[model samples]
Structure formats: C-alpha cells, structure tokens
Target: MDETAQEKKLSAHNASPTQASDHPADPVLSGGFRFDRMELAGAFGDLGTLLPIVIAMILINNLSPSSVFFAFGLLYLLSGFVYRLPIPVQPLKAVGAIAIAYPAVVTESVIGASGILFGAFLLVVSLTGLMDWMAKLFSQAVVRGIQLTLGLVFLKKGIELIIHKDLFMSGAQNRLAEYPVNLIIGITVFALVLLLLDNRRFPAALAALVVGIGSGLALGGFSTLTLAFGPTDVRLISPSMSDYWTALVMLIIPQIPLTIGNACVGTASTCTSLFAGNPLLAKAKAGMFALTMGIVNLPAGFFGAVPMCHGTGGLAAHYRFGARTGGAPIMIGAFFILIALVLGELGFSLLALIPRSVLGVLLVFAGLELCPLLRNLKTNEEYFVALLIAGIALAVPNMGWAFAIGIAVDFFIRKMNVRI
Candidate 1:
C-alpha cells in the first residue's frame, strides 16, 4: 500500500470504537477514576525514569526531598485532573542527566533557573500558538525515528541498571559476577512481566515491586525504616541574573530541541497512536503539552521542584502496565503527597530498597512498548531515515541533534528524488 493509504488505514483502526474501549475497564463509564490494583501498578510504571533523578537531585545537589516530593505530587495531581488521562509528569531527562553528571557545574540555583526560564519559554510559545506550528513541521517518519531512538536509549539504561549494583551498596564487587543474583532477579521479573502483560487481574508492576522489595529485605538492603511527619520546609528559590543567564545558555538552550521533539511532538504523536479512537485522549496538541509544562514548571522553579515534562516514554510506560485513565496519576500523586508530608527523608530510604534489577525489568518492558511504532514505516527511504536518526541519537547521545540531522537528510532525499 502507498503511504497515504497506510496512514488512512492506521487512522481508521485507531478511530474504531473497539480500539478505544479495548482497555480492561471502560474508563469513561468508570468516571475516569480508578484506584484498583491495575491503576496502582500503573502508577509505578515510570518509577525507573523518576526515582534516579529525584534521588540524584536530593543526594548530590542537596535539594530538600520534602519540597521536591511536594512539587512532584502537586504536579501529578494537577496533570491528572487537567488531562483526564494517564498522562504523566516526569523530570526532564536532558536537565536531569546534565545536573546529575556534573553536580559541581550545575548547582541547585542553576537547575531552578533552568526550570523558570524554560517554563516561561514554553508559556510564551504555547500562548502564541508557536508550538502548534512547530508540531506540524515534523513528518511521521521523524516522529517514529524519535520514538525508536528513545526506546533504544531506555533499553541501554535498563540493561545498565540490571548489570550494575546499586550506587549506595558497598563493595565494588560486580553483582553480575558475585552470584548473578541481580541477573537472576532481572530475568525472573522480566518473565513475570511478560506473563502478566495482558492479565488485568494481575498487575506486573505491582508484582515486580513486591518481589523487588521482598528481595531487598531478604538481602538486608533496608536496615531500618522510619516514618516521620512534619511541615516540609519549602523555601522560595530566587535565581540571580547571572544564574538565570547561565541556565538559559547552558541548560535551557540545550534542552529546547529535545523539549520540542520528544516532550511536545513525540508525546502528541504517541497519544494519538495509543488512544486512536478516543478523541479526548488522542488529541493532545503541542500547545496543550507546552501549557502543561509551563503551568507545572513555573511553580516548580520558584519552589525548587525538579523541572518536569510530559514525555512519550512516560506515557508508554504507564500504558504498558495497565493505566487507562487519569486515575493512575492521581493515585501516584496522593502517594507522593503522603510521602512528602509524612516520610520526607525516610522516603528516599524506602525507594533505595527497590532492587535495581526489578526496576531494570520495568524499564526494558517500557522500552519494548514503544518499539511497535517503528512498524509503521512504509517505505525503504522512511526506514533508512528512521534508522539513521536512531543511530545518530544513540551515538551523539542527543535527541535534538539527531532530529535536526534526520530532518535535513529526509528533506535532501525527497528534494533530490533519491531512491535509497
């Protein structure tokens, strides 16, 4: 079939009522709110993406856990209500990676400023409808390429997490070599995930978490567990002019292309793919996405919240498990709020006890969930462009550069009528 015909067929399939109502439960009739086992399991589907950054910011940058949790919880709660879907609020990966890798160079103030500046930028673009305009510029091939690249990225990270021991754990002894305990755990969880992928009665993520926590406790990973309740100290962060400038140049500038490509365009595309028949869930435009970022980050920046975004990966992770409505984020948000208000520092300790192998299994499956989009490529040229973008993205370790190069190559090929 021709590209146009293929596109039409896919659209038709997505718009079918059967596809829309394929979830284990009808979200619309359920009042779009569910706190069942599947929803709770879906809540942790993106923990592999969330916890590392939160822990890094707290441990390395000395950011207050309570404040961060509060911001995270608050945003998750707001996003669920506003989007009325399983749409997630995730830490911006670009900013998190840079901040975590170079803690000395990227201070808390710098991170805070990056959030504020980026928030303002998104707000302006969203208000001006520039986001919508930009979103239209990318072809389906480009979007698919971005998804493929991200899937591979997640796969790489998941493997790393599985093979390596926890950073907090002592003894440089390799977990894979010592007794292959982590490897065994990873395989077991992976098999379990596969087995339960389609079983609504059994939530794979929740089961994985249970196994992970159980294994951690057996290994004496959590020596002590304490719960403390107190007023979280949330202080206003006022970045100086220099700090703002530095963040704009160093952090925000580098992140803009990624924000545009993955957070906005890719996310919107994935929503359409996943919820093809459900107009309300599928029609996430770039402007709406940017607005969410602006709304969440504005407060997050001022209060030292981890800068956040709604990315395609997070959405896929949530859907891969069992989340079918806004209830997932609401449930997770409430959990975070409780942690922030009651557990505070102790929350980190509990998170630390979750075996890295289990988290790795989750990441692996999340990555796998995103791989289906690649099957949409119709032509050899399209496949070439997508593969090129994925290769470049992995090699350069930058999605923005990959996107730019892919677009240029695609344009050149089309203009020249080059049949590769």
Candidate 2:
C-alpha cells in the first residue's frame, strides 16, 4: 500500500495508541522502496538460513532443484508484489532440519506430501480466522520468547556449522579439510560484518559475501561446481498414504507450533514494530501471514519443494542491512530464477564453494539482530515467561514444546492475578 492510502486506513480505524510499543523502533518503512547497492546487498540477508537447508534437501533427498528454486523465486516475488515489504520467506526450519538429518525417512515423496497436507491445514486455520483467536493467547512476552527461541536455534545451528560438528546435514564437505579453514573464514567474515554493519557506503552482507566467495575460491571451491543451461525440471508428485502418514507424524506435528508462534505471530509483530509508524504496515496480521504461507506451500508441496514460511530473523537481517522496500526480495527472486535456469540440478553445488563457516556467520548475525525485540519485555513476570521459554526451547530443542509451556504459564499467571 502507498503511504497516502495506508495513512487513510489508519485514520479511518478511529484509533491510534500513544505509539505501538511492542518492539524496538526500526525506522525502515519511512524510506519506501529502493533498488540501489544497499538493497542489492541486503537481498542476500537470509541466505545463511536459506542455503544450507536448500542444499541439504536437494542433495540428500534427491529433491528437484529446479522445483525448489522456482518455488522460492515465485514465493519471493509474490511477497514483494503483495506486501510491498521485505517480509521474509524461509523454508519450514524444523521440517527441513528433520528431513536433512534423516533423509532415509524424509524421502522426496514424504517431503512433497507433507507440503500438501500442511498447507491445507494452515489454509483452513487462516481462512476461518482460527489463528486470530489463537494469536490473542500470545502476549508480548510470549512473542519475545518465540523470537528468542528461534534466534538461539539459528545461533546454535551456525555454531555447529562453524565447528563442523555434524557436517553431513548440509552436504558440505570441509574443502580445506586438513585445517579449520571454516573456523578461520567464519571469524574473518564475522569481524568484517561487525565493522561495517552500520556503514551504508559498504553494506555488511555485501562485504561479507565478497570475502567469503574470495576465500572459497582460494580454497579450491571452484573445482566442485558444474555449469548447466536451459530449463530446470519440475513435475508434480503423487504421494501415497504412507507418505502422508510419515509427514503428519514426523514433520507436521513437530513443526506446527513453530510455524504458528514464530512464522505467523512472531513475523507479524516484528513487521509492526519495525514499521510501527504506519498503521497499514502494523495491520499486517497473523492470519494474513499464515494465508500467504498456505497459499505458496500448496504449490510448493505438489512440486516436491520444501515447505516455506516467514521468519522474524529474516526480516531483521534484511532491514538491518538496508533493504527498505520490496525491491530487495525482487532482486533475490530474480536471482534465484536465473540460477535455476543456468544451474538446473547443479544449482546447489555452486554454493558449496563458500565455506560453511561463512554461512554460519550470516545465521549468527541474523539472530543477533533479533535481540532488539526482547527490549520491550519490561516486568519481571514477563521476563520470567520469556526467559523460561527461551531456556526450554533450547534445552528441549523444540520450539513447539517451548511455546506450549510458555502459553500455559502465561494463562495461569493471568488467571491467578499474580506476578512471577
């Protein structure tokens, strides 16, 4: 929506609180859209979270790279055109993680089928306004808890990559295996990003990628890459009853709460906070977020693509690195489409050139950007719930369980009329 139209909608509502104090003041919306160096640079913000899972799924599960990249490209374009904001679109993290870790169980048919059923479920919930009521159950503290939980999850994943703890998940073989090149490269890029994080003249993400790519080429990354041309293969899948059952039990059950808490609620709240000055932007609802995820995943599921959703961390990464408008995602969308065309099934191996450590740094920084969200949790009771959620999520290694425990405690406190 344009500024004038958004301004009108906000005024017609007949309400505007003193100021939306939900999250920290991130004034990106004030600039509208731009297609400059910074937007180009910021376009790569979420690749850290995006690339590894994509690579793993394609390499491990024999997924159609063309379909996956095409789905991502289309989804990115849809979000750009519809919301006209740099709203993040990411693979369903838990689903992708589980599939990568256990490719034997999460076969291509199972992954595709999971998308079909899960998308339908979210569509029902979103269209019926069920998520709206469910969202009200989430307090600011709970949202913060979700944010912290996902951030920590991203942090832990990045650390694991840097140290090469379980390297097979990403299909990334340590190219410079003799020594800890990933660790060294990770530290170098991490430092470079920190030094230039706020420098508009030289965006952090852009600088980091340049360094990482250079390091990768120096370490014999180019030898592994193969170039292909022409259209990428894409076809629909016919999932069996067993595929659906596996998807339901292993993928959907564990992923639902994270999708609800982080993807819908966490993302919408982060959008409102970052774009707080605009009531239209603030009006970006959890239902709308869910609807988009459902809409995209419907096709993504049919075509053997990994399920996708929004994330607070991706938004923070984009905005912090200087993506002011939908242009950032458009740039990325087009990039992916081009890659799918040129690289075809070889789309993933090209990225294997960059050190895993560099990818880890991107994830770490994205998580750090989410720290600003926790600043608004003022009271001790709020802190208790949020921190407890964070602790449980990391310890249990499950966002679904953490969200359940957090909301239960939130309701209990409210009913008791007591502070922690």
Candidate 3:
C-alpha cells in the first residue's frame, strides 16, 4: 500500500476507540456511568411519571416498607437476569403507591413487582415473534376493548382522587387541599405536556412532573428534604409458603390483566407511536413481558412480597425522558435497590414530603394518557365490548376475572361472527 493509504488506515484505527467511547453500546450494564442523552432525559422526565405511581402503590396497596424492599430486590434481580431485555428494571413504586390507595381494594398486596414481571414476559414474547399469533387470537375489537376498559378504570381512579379529598389525612392537616392541588397540578402539567409533546423543545413529561412536584414543594406542598438518606436497616420479610400461595392466587388471577392488558400493551403502543415507528411490536412486547412477570411473581410471592407491574405513569415518564431502549428501566432498577437499602423512615419521610394532592395531579395527568381510547367508542361493537370490559373490571375488583371476561367476550364474538 502507498504511504498515504497506510496513514489513512492508521488514523481510522486510532479514531475508532474515541468514537466507541462517545457512547456505550448498552445503557443498562455499562460501568463508566457516562450518561446517555436518553438516560438523562428519561431520568428527569420520569420523576413525575413515577411519583403518582409510587404514591398510589403505597396508599392503595397498603404495603409495608419491608415488603417494598423485597419487591424491589426481586425486580432488580429479574430485570437483570431472567428477561434478558436490554432494559434496566426497577420495582414499580407506583404499584406500591397504587396499592396503598386502593388498599387491597383491587388486588392484594400491590407492593410487589408482579405486573413488571408480567410486562417483561410480554416483551420477551414480542421479541420472539409470538405476539402476532397471540394478537390473532383476539380481534382488534377485543384489544381496543381492553384499552378502553383500562382507560375508563384509570379515569375513575382519577375522579376518585378528587372525590376522596377528605379521606387522605396526615397529622392535623385536612389534606382536602390535595384535591384542588392535584387538579391544578394535573391541568398545568398536562397542558405543558401537550405543547412540549408536539415540539420536543424540552423534556416535556419530565418538565411537567418536575414543575408539578417542585411547585408542590416550593409552595410548602410537600418536603422530603428533612428526611434521612443513607443505608437503611431493612428487614427482609419471611412469610410462610402459604402466604406465597395466597399472594400468587391474588396476583395471578385478579391482577394479571393489569399487567398483560393494560400496562404491557399501553407501554408498547406508546413506544411504537413515539420511537420505533410501529405498533406491532407494542402488541407483541406487551404479551412477552406479561408472561415474564408471571414467572417472576410466582416465586417471589412465597417470600411475603407483593406483585409489581408497569404503570402508564412510569412509561410516560420513561418516554418523556427519551429512553430508547431498556436502559431506562435498568437505571430505575438501580434506584429501587438503592432505596431498598438506604430508605427507611427517611425515605418514607421524603415520600411524605410529596403532598398527596400533588400525587393526585400526577394520577390525573396519567389518566389523561388513556383518553385516546375514547375514540374507540365511535365504533358500535367495539364500544359495546369495551364498556362491558370496563364495567366488569370496575365491578369485579379482581383484575384476573376482569381480563378473563374481556378475553371470553372475544371468544363469543368470534363464535358469532359478529365482526366485533
């Protein structure tokens, strides 16, 4: 080779390492901690996305801190090990918060990572190309039905927050203010979100969540700054094998749909709509991850833990933060592990700093994400099936049966050839 050509080759070889160093191949396991643009965006944007979810799990699920820790530990382990997705995983804190709000009202012990496990399974199935076949099993009507049902359910939940301002009290505070605060926060954030969503001028979701949360804090809305933060002395919970069985039954039956139907599907659709330029993967991924979550929950339930799942709230945050791959989840998982170890009264205290009203705002905005499904009602059979699913889901209070009803409806529709 000529000297000029050899020099060019040498320069190219030397430059490769620098180019490689500019970005890690994967965000989850990379050791150097060089923040990816998506990671930073997701980190900041997801905070609000995560807030209402975490709050809901705590209030609705009625889980203890120990249970929370165990769930996170399991989530961390599975996200890194079993699913093998490029995504980072964390305990669904929103699951915990939602559990707390509903308080075994819908599913028992909502603090665990069961939903997330399910989502992971669904994701795997999608990746493996099983989703299309699965999708064929149900009609577009059934799928849209499920989406509409979940949207309505979440909408009710948002309204319930508004309705129950008198109930969520702390110390001497009425917390009634939380209702209006939530309304204001939610409206403001949502409006901003819609605008930024169109332009991408800023990290819209994260900004909305931050503005809402920060406004709450600045206005004496909530404050965790005084709370403790360090290594927490967490006690691992050990429940009997029976408790596991009970938890398994509770999670596997009633709440499975929440994972498969709502969370997994919702997330996949959002991603497809936003990033990958296709919604087919969303359908497949949701089911794949749902199955994975089932496997994770089966064993973890025996350890006195609650189940976990992704929330639209968190996914919205993930999307807002610009998370392209699974790396956002991986980062979230690390956060869970750290909180499990270091959060105690301090952590709870920090959580306390978030006004219940502010959290309500988060939930309200989250519910709005489901609004796109309102278009489903424009169709006849779809509207009928969707309302039926929503009614069943809202009434039965068991997620399993609710999903079963929807799927069962699918069978009936197919048998009749009604074209629903």
Candidate 4:
C-alpha cells in the first residue's frame, strides 16, 4: 500500500471508535473488564471465609440464615448498581459471622440492619469528607485505639469459636454422647476446610459447606421439610411483630454504631490497606449500597434470617486469592442464598455435623494468622491502642460504657502527649 494509505489505516486503528462515531453503544472505556490476581482472589476468597462464620452465626446466634442471605444479596447488588466501585464487601461478613451470634444469644432473636446502620454512619462521614476532618480532632493514639479494638474484636471471637465449640449446640451437656453424628459432621467439615485451604483449588469454607450439605443429605437432614414459596397456614406463620420490634429495639443501641463504625474504621481500612498497590478507582456508591441490601433483606427477614454484611477479613482472603471486583460477591452471595433457601435444612444440618475440636482448630489457625499485624505495631502508642481496643471488646458486655471507656482511654493518652 502507498504511504498515505498506510498512514490513514494506522490513524483509523489508533482512534477510539467512540471518538469517531456519531453514536456508540457505550463509551469504549466501558468495554474493558479489569481483572487482577489479588483483587479477584479477594473477591472469590470471601466464600471460604464467610461459610464458617455463617454456620457459627446460625447455630450460636439462632439467627435465620435468610437474613444473612438477603443482606449479602443486597450488599452485592448495591455495590454494583449503586456504589459502582466494586470494593469487596467481606468485612461485614467476618464481623457478622462472629458477632451476630453473641447478640442473638443475648436478645433471643435474629436482628438485621444494625451493621448497615453503622455503615451508614461512616458512609455519611466519608461522603461528607468528614473522615479527613475527624482525623485531626483525634490523635494517632485515638485512631489506633479504635483499630486495636477492632482487631481484638476479631481475635477474641476467633478464640471463642475454638474454645467453646459446644456452647451453641442443641442438647444439654449430658446429651453430648447422643450427638456423635453432629460431632463427626462438624469435625469432618472443619478438616475439609483445612484441606481446601492448603490446596487452594477450591475455597476451604465453601468445600466445608459442600461437605456439610452432602453429609446432611446423606443423613436425611431435610426430613423435616416446612418452608416453601406458597402462602399456606402450614408455611405462612409470621414472626411476632412485637417480638421483632423488641429485638430491633434491643439491637438498636448496640448494632447501629457497631456496624457503621466498624465499616469505616475496620472494613474500609482493611480493604484500602489490602488494595494499596492497585490502580486508582472511583469511590464506592452509597445509596445504592443501602438500597441493594434493603431490597433483599426486607423480604428475607419475614422468612427467618439474620442480616448479613460484607466482611473485611473475608475480603482480604478474596484479594489473597484473585477476585477482581463486585463479580465475586455476586457469585458468593448467590451461592449462599441458594443454600439457605433451596437447601436450608440440609445446609444447617451439615454445618451442625462439624466436630468442635476441628472447628476450634480452624478458628485458631485463622486467629494465629493475624499475629503479624500485632508485630507491625512497633510503637508504644500502637501497643496502647491495641490493648485498649482489646480491653473494651472484653469489657463492653460487663460494662455499659464500652464506647465511653474507649474514648476515655484515647483522651487520656492524647492529653499525656503520647506519640504513636
């Protein structure tokens, strides 16, 4: 071809079609689907991290799995449709998986949305650009105090899962001998989880979940079939609205801040730290995030479920694996919903089979993995922060002023001219 013709062809190839077109289906930039090994891993890895948490939450908290399912479903939908920045939503999952049960144990009913409320608190701060402003009023000591508290919250719960495996079981201590089947199932699931983690072929938690489901089916776990789509006298019994109101009221004081504060200081921070090396992306959408979860959770609650949240720990795991964006949450959330709905009894029964010892071992490994974070705290300020946070987490139940205590500690440290 002639030089002029060749130059014209090169120019055509170089120019974006949208730049040249009068109208385009979408801007050319929209066509590319970004993927990274760590982000993708983080997204997909959440399933494994979330499963055990789900099991523990369900059994210990006596919260409905439906709530978790709906919450997550909404979270993912909102992450994509609203936030538009596909940050992983696993922090809430990790937190909920561990903490939801405790609140349920206290309240005697499942609760939802408190975590979202907490997130809303932070979301408002972030959206209004107040985190930067608040950053000044508190010294590093105060922030570290909050960080330490968050870490210990996770660590303490991790220890509890391992140490008190039978605390949430159905029968009394004397009837333990009758639950050989449950022990076997639980132990097996725990072992399977470790095996999967070692191999990294499939997710450890998801593998455990599958094994639990299979075992449940084998053991005739679904024998007591009750729930379905149809509205009948048999299946349509409503949860006492008064009881629900009481539960919500009971949860309000604790959950709203717990969920929202944790999201800002814990989940957002974790994801930000984990994805530090990644390319710049837009800030996540807020209203859509809330709307997405609200859409699913409102329905799921009526059917007996706990509210779910995206967990940071779970998100970190996904990043370690290879999930790129919101796509991973969609997959995990959908899978969870399917299990809770179509295979409810089977899934629960399977989870019930895990052995306490094995479960303990799994949680212990997870907790130990966090030791390096402690090592990174080289300053006295960090030490103070970590201990203070852990202490409040330990004391919050016994002391009515956990938040006040944390703040007081921070104030005292700041007044003393501590440098962290």
User: What is candidate 1's CA lDDT for residue 198?
Assistant: 66
Stretches of candidate 4 off by over 4 Å are: 1-68, 80-198, 214-249, 280-305, 317-324, 339-366, 369-371, 398-404
Model 1 CA lDDT for position 302: 84
What digit string (tens of lDDT, one per residue) describes model 3 on residues 45-142?
Answer: 43433444544454445445444554655564454343322232334432444345445443432223344344445556656766545544444445
Give the per-residue lDDT of model 2 (tens digit) for 320-401.
6767568888888888887776767455556656667778888898887676567666688888999999999888856799
TM-score of each prediction: 0.90, 0.89, 0.64, 0.61
Candidate that beats the other on lDDT, 1 or 3, i.e. the better one: 1
The positional error of residue 371 in candidate 1, measured at the CA in angstroms, is 1.3
Worst lDDT 10-window in candidate 3? 11-20
Give the alpha carbon lDDT tens digit for every residue of 145-175 in model 4.
Answer: 4445544554565455445535233322323
Better of 3 and 4 by lDDT: 3
Write the candidate numbers in order of decreasing TM-score.
1, 2, 3, 4
Q: Cα lDDT of all candidates, in order?
A: 0.78, 0.77, 0.47, 0.45
lDDT of 1 by residue, 352-385 (tens): 6776778788888888878777887878898999
Give per-candidate clash totals. Answer: 0, 0, 67, 39
